[model samples]
Structures are given as structure tokens and as C-alpha cells.
Target chain A: MIAEIASVSFIGGLLSLDVSAWGQIMVSRPIVCGPLIGLLLGDLKTGLIIGVLLELIWINVISVGAAIPPDATIVAVTCTTLIILTESKLSLGSDFHGSYRMVVLALTMPLAEFFKTIDVKQRKLNARFVHYLDREILKGNLKAVGKVNNFSLFLVFLRGFLFSLVAISVGVYILPKLFSYLPYAMLVGLNFAYRLMPALGLAIAFNTFRGL
Target chain B: MQNLGFLYILVPVLDKLYPEKEKRIQSYRRHLEFFNSHPYFANVLVGIVARLEEEMAKEGEVKSEEISAVKMSMGGAFGGIGDSLFWGAWRPFTALVACVLVIIFLGKWEGAWLGPVIFLFLYNFLHFHTRFKGVLEGYEKKTKVVRLLKKMYYLRTIWSSHVVGLTLVLLTGLVVLFRDWEAIERLYFLAFFLSIILLNRWRISAARLLYLLIGISCVGGYIF
Candidate 1:
């Protein structure tokens, strides 16, 4: 149980730092961070590959001054997680191609983004949190704000991590049913994602040279 | 340093309150050195500090004299640097870079133990090689290794990141060329990248590039 708790908390700690401290590094990005974490949970290669797809399609996604761009972190992590689950299941014995799994997640990312707007509302608490910290610190009452920060960071981490865990778990559990509904385009989309990355990278470079 | 993590401030506070003054002070002043010793341990050290502080102040939780002084000092001195480096830059960059690389290279199901493994290895060993040299550590300062590392640190990291980005682009190109209509999709994405650079160089701004990028986005779908 401690392992589970630690897993949740680790996700929380990571999420806390994503916006607050670790924004400078791209480790928190789904491609890198998701795969790294996925490696821990096993199936790192799939995580890495899926991450590449998300990274390209949403290359410009970023939170800017006072604006929370969609939670690509969740979108990425959740999708990768599903791919891992589905791929492994198919690999084991199922007569299925797991590629459709990520396709579903890809389709759902916008929905996930819609739900994640709730995070921006929590952003409103930043000022009040700072005020609380100041008042407590001045009063020599470290407990008030320290606990607040700790708990706030915990919840911040928990919400995304849990949401992801549940979403992935549910998606993984139900993929066989969803497989029935998918069109041929799903396979093409997956195939496109597989190649889209290198194309974008070269384009970025070629364009850089041409303009220069 | 991408940014100093809030953990920086945490370390010094723990150092001040620590029952053992000497080790704590030494570790505090030479925190990076200690970190060079072990990242996981350093994280544990961070956890210890927070947990100890909580344990010490559980109930009515009157702040101790030493803890209060440390807190007062923390807000003014350590907190700023910690906030700036960790919050403002370093941690975000590190976290994002790490996560992004993992996602791209490894994916959600796949993984890259090497990346983090190399990170841990380099973090612990590279910065502290002089320790093995001991007395020579003083003399070896005569070499350019320190500056060399610093320079390499500057160039190699940026170089590597660009490589990752470039690789992504190339992958996208091959995929497009093969998967979709040969000529149209190829030319469209070609034009997309061309425009990205032109826009950036001309100061066309992202707002305007949106029109062009929208067309480019469609190219991916068209290729499919």
C-alpha cells in the first residue's frame, strides 16, 4: 500500500513542480516524462513512441502569461498509459492491434482538456495562498502556510494523477468493446502519428535554413 | 541551474534546525556537493526536513526559536533564490526537458532508463571527479576540465535538445512522404516549415502564423 501511496504522491510531487519549478526543463513534458515514468511501470519503449506522437501534434501547446494551455501532461500521460496497457494485452494473446487504443485517447484529449479547465480555477488560489503564507510567517506561525502549501501541492498532484490513473484504467479495461466502433481511419491516424514526428523535425530545420 | 528548486530553501532550514550543527552546516553550504553525492538521498534529505519540521510542530505548534529564525531568514534570502531558480526556471526546464524527452523517445508505454540513469550517473560523478584525486584535486584545478565541463555543459545540452527537436521533424517528413500523396503533402509541410522560419525571421508573430499553421495542420490530415 505504501508503494501505491508513494506512486500517487510521486505523481503529485512531479505535478506540483511542473508548473511551479520544473517548467524550465522539459522533463515534465509527456514524451520524456511520461516514458521515463512508464519505464518504471514497465513498457518504456511504447511510452517513448507514444510520447513522440503527442509531442509533435501538440508542439506549440504551452501555458502563457496567466493562461493555462490545455493539460497536455494529462493528455500525454493518459494516452501513453493506455497504449502501454493495450499493447501489452494484445501482445500477450489478444488478436488485436493496440494502435487503436492511443487513437481513442487522441480523440479524448480535447474532452480531457475541457475537464481540465478546473485547474485554472484553482490558480485563483495562488494570491490567497501567498497571503496566507505571509500572514502566518509574520505571526511566526509556520504551520498554517506550510501545511497549506503541502496540502495544496498534494491535491494539485493528486487531481491530475488520479484522473489519469482512472481514465487510463477505464480505457484499458474497455478497449475490446471500443475496438468494434473504430473506423479504418483510426489505423491511418495511428500510422500518421508514427511518422509525423520526423517530418515535423525536418521541416523545422529546413525552414530554419531557408529563412536564414 | 534551470532554477533552484524550493528544495534549496528546505535544505538550509533543515541545516539550521538540525541537532548536529557541524554536518548540517557543512552540508548546507556545500549542498550542491552533497547533491553531487546522491540525488535520491538529496530528495530523501528534503523529505526528512519537511517531515521533521511537521513532527516538531504538530499541535498548538508554537514555533521554536531556531525554526522561527530560520523561517524569517528563509523568506528574505533563501526563498528568493529558491523561488527564482527552481520555480522560475531550473526545475521547470529540467522537469519539462526530462518529461518531454522521455515521451518522445520512449513514449507512454516505452521507456528510457538510460536518460535518467545517465542523469543520475553524471549528476553524481562528473562534477566530483576531483575527489578521487584528493590532494591532486588542488593541483588538477590546473587543468581546464572544470571550464571544459562548464562549456560542454552549455553547448552539449542545447545541442542535444536541438537534435531531439530536429529528429522529430525528420521523422515527420519521412512519415508524410510515405503515408500520404507523394507530391502535395510533401510540398505543403515543406511550405509549412518554410513559413515558420519566414514568420519568425520576419517578425510575423505567432498570431499571424496561426493562419499559415492552420493550413499546415490540415496538411497532416490531408496526408492521412
Candidate 2:
């Protein structure tokens, strides 16, 4: 489990980098990163299902100028990792659209909101790094500029790694037990809602595109 | 990330243009002022700024204030256009297409890995290709990138329309698959769809809308 968390969190860091650390590559997107993590966890279906769902709903969320959208990449990596890991431990069957998955999905949405606040704080800290660079430049320390920029990227990477590590670690312990207590009928409803979620996802996608 | 990301572009360009130490320092300082825009769209401005800086260094034809003016003016426009087209349209369109492909080929868990591979390949191909191309066009052609952006607007429209069609088809597939759904369930689905559209139109946050959906679905679960 430690090995899995470490490796997956590293990948999370890389994808999180796509949000701002480097190229605006779409790799950080849920559709891409979620499946990739799922593949690593030996459950491609879990990853793809979660990825596609998150991609559909959060399709319009973006970092336009100063506004930071929820860190969908972290949400993707953390949720997919937790879902697959928990399922393997519980010896659950390969029903990717089951109620357990829906419960996990429900729990994951708010997690993105939490991580987004962390991201805002990290950017604020990065602003201080920028100021430090400005002072270094004033002192004719051109070489320091590269170090400062690289350090900022490192900070973001570290933040991603730690967040993923903690989120997945906690999620694996909480999600299964939480769902295990639900009534059979409620589980059935969750499964139904899980199936119906794609419609809402598609509607969100349509709302986004219609505005275009 | 936005400010630092652009520094990578500006530093090298400024380095090549300004050989004098003092001049290079001035160039760096000038650019270090707060600048933010959509990252992908910022490439065009980076290209344009590189060109303007080159003009300033080589012929002194452009004033510093004019370059700053160009950056300020183009920043908001690019942000709006880039957000609308790339974030609003292109991403959702490709994602919907990917989702449809996944449903078609791997819905039953057969060869599921292929879905993510296709999605990553298709999205990155469009994303990085246009990103680099935007920079090149902005650098080589400067203001003429507007024409290219106009072309992009048409492409975005075409792609978005296709996504809408694909989504409707997928929704139809759902209705067909669940033919045995209770009448109340069907009505609930209709209400869910309508509420999503109406709430989205009213500009509710996606997260909040999702929370509402989940809450309502959970309560409906007990009643049904």
C-alpha cells in the first residue's frame, strides 16, 4: 500500500504540474490522468469511469487568469486511487458502476474543493517567490532567477505529492466502511444515481458548449 | 505558474536580444511586472512580445510603453477568447467524443485501457500542436494571428456542435438501455435533466449543482 501510494502520488505530482508548473498540456485532465492512475493500479475501468465522469462535469472549470478551478487532477488521481485500492482490499467484485463507486465519487467532489484552497495558498506563497526573484534581479543576481523558478516548481510538486498521499491514505480507510453501513435500498438508489450521473455530466457539457 | 511560465519564454528571448548587461537587466525588470492570462493563450502574447522586444533592440522602432500597452490590451482579449474557445468548447468537445468512444468500444469492460490511451493521444495532439503553432504564428506573423484565431473560432463552433449531437445520442442510448425504468424514475430523470440545465443557466457552480443532484437523488432513493 505504501508503494502504491508513493508511486501514484508521484504521478499525481507530474499531472498537477500540468496545471501550472509547465506546459498547459491536457495531461492533467481527468480523462487522461485518471485512467493512467487506474492502469497503474491494475483497474483501468475504475479509472476510466471516474475520469470520464469528472471530465464531463468539470469540463468548463479552468484557470482563466487569476481564477483557479478546483484541482481536477488531484481529484482524479486521489479518488481513482482510493476507489481501486479500497475495492482490492475489500475483495469487491468488478462492478465498476456499483454503489460503492458512487459513494466514493460523491465524497471525492468536495475533496477537490478542499485541495483548491491549498492551491490558492501555494500560489500566494509563489507570489512571494516572485518578489524574492525581483529583489535578486535588482542585485544583479541573474543566476538566482533559474533557481527561484525551479524552486517554485518543486514547491508545487511537493504539495501535490503530500496532498495525494494524505487524501488517498485517509480515503481508503473511510470510504469502504462508510458505504458498508448503507441500507440495501439506498445502495440501489446510489447505483441508479451513478448510472444517471452521466446524464447530468452530459448536460453540464452541453451547458458549457452552448455558451460557446 | 502563469507568471513563472512566461518567464521561461521571456528570459531566453530577452537574453538573445539584449547583449549588454544593463540592458538585459532592464528588459528582465520590465517584464517582471505582474502579467497573467490563460497559459495557452499567453503563448501568442509571448510571441508578439518577443517580436516587439526584437524590434526595440534591433531598430529601436517600438517604445517600451507601447510594448507594455500591447501586452495589457491583448491580455484580456486573449483571456476571453481562449477561455471561451479552448476551455469552454474544445476541451468539452474532445472529452465528450472520448467518452462516446469509450462507451462504444469499451462500455462492457473490454479493452478499457484503450479508452484512456485514445483520450490522452487525441487531446494532447490537439493541445500541444496548437499551443506551439500559436506561439510560432504570433512570433512570425504578429497581429496576423488574429486571422488564425478567427479560423479557430469556426473550428470551435463545428466541434462544439458535434459534441452536443454526441451527447444527445448518448442520452438516447441511456433511455433505450433502461427501458424498464419506472414511470416515476423516468419523470425524475426528466426533472434532473431540466434542473441541471436551468441551474447551469442561472450560473450555479458545478460543484454546488452536483451536490444538489446527489442530495436530491439520495432523498428520492428512500421515497422511490
Candidate 3:
């Protein structure tokens, strides 16, 4: 379990880097990272389902200008990791198993906002790098430019790695325990909510075209 | 900030063009001024600036202030177009297609993985094309690259993508309903869908709606 958490956190760190610190490739998008994490954890199907759901839900949550949107990629990574890891721990063929994904998703969704706050702080800290480079360039230490840029990228990676590491570590310990305490009635409700999730996604996607 | 990024990208070019340390530092300082644009499209400005700097190095005709002016104006213009076309339209269109593919084929077929593959391929194809070609075109044609972008009919693509995305959303709702749902389940799905669409008019955010739906579900679960 410790090994699994560490490996997933490592990959999660790299994927989060794609968000802004490095490549802006759509790989950072939930649709990609969800399944990627799923495949790593040996549950591709759960990854795909969760990826598509999160992708649609946050489809319009783009970062325009300095306004940082909630970090959907982190949510997808954490949620998918939690579901796949916990699903294996619980005994199979249970009545509540089917709705487990929804419960995990509902609980984990707020992590997006939490991750964003951290992300905004990181960006604020990055301003110091610019001033540092400005000073170095004035000193004719042109080589410091690449070194500082690489260091900044490393910092971004470290931020992501440590964030996922802690989030997943704490989540793996807490989620299944909380899930076990849920009554059967609540499980059924979550099942219904799970099935209705696509509708919510579709409606939000439709809203993107609202004024068009 | 993008200013630092702009400086980083121009470093090699500046190094080559200005061998004298004082001149090179001046060129570096020049690029360190404010710069921001869509990441992909920013390459075009980089190319243009590189070319202008080369000319300034060789012939001493182009003024430094003119280069900054070009960066400011074109950065703003490209930022607007790139935001609308790529973020507003192209991304959603490609993402919708991938999602609908996932909804339709995830369980029934082994080809479910193709959704993400096709999405990456389709998106990056245009993305790389614009990124690489924009630089060359901007270097070759300079400001006339704007004319080239205008001829690409990006507005038409934006409009069509939105229309297609709307259709796909409706199609996904239908498929989800009839796929395996019972009558009661179907009714519940419809209720949630309509209420969400209606709630959207109140400008409720997606995150808020997410929590609200879950809250309702938990309570309804306890009752029914």
C-alpha cells in the first residue's frame, strides 16, 4: 500500500507539472490523467469513468488571465487514486460497492479548491525567481537564467509531488473507514447520484454554449 | 511571470546577435519587459522579435521601442484570438468528442481507450501545427501574420464547434437514459438534468451544483 501510494504520487506530481509549470499539453486534463492513474493502479475502467465525469464537470473551469481556477487535475488524480485503492481493500460483491465511486467523488471534489489555493501561493512565490533572474542577468551571469528556470520547474514538481503524497496518504487511511460507517440507505442514494452524474456533466457542458 | 519566460526564450538568440557583453545585457533587459499571451501563439511573437533583433543587429534600422510596441500590441491581439479559438472553442469540442466516445463505448467495446488516444492525437495535431508554423510565418511575414490568421476562418470553426458540442451534450443525455436505466431511474435523471439546466440560469457554479446535488441525494437517500 505504501509503495502504491508513493508511485501514484510521483506520477501525479509530473501530471500536475503539465498544468502550468511546464508543458501545457492537455495531458494535465482530467480526461487523460484519470485513466493514466487508473491504468497505473490496474483499474483502467474506473479511471476512464471518473476521468470523463470530472472532465465534463469542470469543462468550463478555465484559467483566464491571473484568475486561477480550481485545480481539476489534482481532484481527478486524488479521486481516482482513492477510488481504485479503496475499492480493492473492501470485500467484493457487497451491495454498497457499486456506489462507492460516487461517495469518493463527492468527498474528494472539494480538494480542487484546496489545491488551487496552494497553486496560487506557488505562483506568488515564483515572482521571486523573476527578480532573482533579473539580478543575475545584470551581473552578467547569463548562465543563471537556465539554472533558475530549471530550479523553478523543480520546485513546481516538488510542490505537486508532496501535495499528492500527503493527500493520498491521508485519504487512503480515512476514506474507506468513513465509507464503512455509511448506512445502506445512504449507499443507495449515492448509487442514484452516481447514475445521475452524467446528466450534471452534460448540463454543464451545455451551459458552455449558453450564449452562443 | 511571462516576462521572465519571454526573456528565457530569447536568451540564445540574444547571445548570438549581441556578442558584446554590454549590448547583450541591453537586449536581455529589453525583452524582460512585460509580456503575456497564449502559450502556443506566443511563439509567433518570439519569432517576429527574433527576426527584428537580427535586423537591428545587422543594419541598425529597427528601433528597440518599435520592437516593444510590436510585442505589446500583438501580444494583446493574439491573446484574445487564442483564448477564444483554442480555450473557448477547440478544447471543449475535442473534449466533448472524447467524452461522448467514452459514454458510448466504454464498457461495450474494447475500443474505449481509443477515446483518449484520439483526443490527444486530434488536439495535438492542430496544436503543434499552429505552434511550429506560427513561428515560421511570423518570422517570414512579420506583422502580416495577422492577415494569415484572418484567412484561416477561426470564427467559423469556433461557431461550428459550439454548435456540435451542444448537439453532443443532448445526444449523451439520451444515450445515458436509454442505455440501462429503469423508468424511475430515467425520471430521476430527467429531473436532475432539467433542474441543473434551470439552475444554470441563476448562474450557479458547477461546483456549487455538485455539492447541492450530493446533499440532496444524501438526504433523499435517508428518506426514500
The model with the greatest TM-score is 3
Which lDDT value does model 3 have at B149?
Answer: 86
| lDDT of each residue in B147-183, candidate 3, tens digit only | 8887875567766778778888998889888986887
Candidate whose lDDT is highest: 3
Give per-residue lDDT, candidate 3, residue A111.
Answer: 82
lDDT of 2 at A102: 75
Per residue, candidate 2 scores C-alpha lDDT tens digits across A1-212 of: 89999999999988888876777668888888888998899988778888888887888786666787787889889889988888765544556346777787778878788888988898889888888888888888887767888888888888888988888888888887887688766766777778677678777876776665
lDDT of 1 by residue, B1-224 (tens): 10023334464465455546454443333222211112211232234335445445345253444433433332333233323322233322333343334434442333354554443343335223322332233233322223433443433443344445444445545544665437655764565456455555554422234334333333544565
The per-model DockQ list reads 0.17, 0.53, 0.72
Tens-digit lDDT track for model 1 on A1-212? 23533463366347535643333234555545556656756766666655554544444443332345566666666666556555654432333343354345445566435535767666556545655554554554444434665666666776666665666567666765666565555445444433334444334343432321
- Candidate 3 residue spans exceeding 4 A from truth: A91-93
| Clash pairs detected, candidate 2 | none
lDDT of the candidates, in the order given: 0.45, 0.77, 0.85
Worst window of 10 by summed lDDT in candidate 3 chain B:
B152-161
TM-score computed on alpha carbons, candidate 2: 0.89
lDDT of 3 by residue, A5-92 (tens): 9999899889988887777878989899999999999999999999999999988877665568888888899989998888878753
| CAPRI classification of candidate 2 | medium
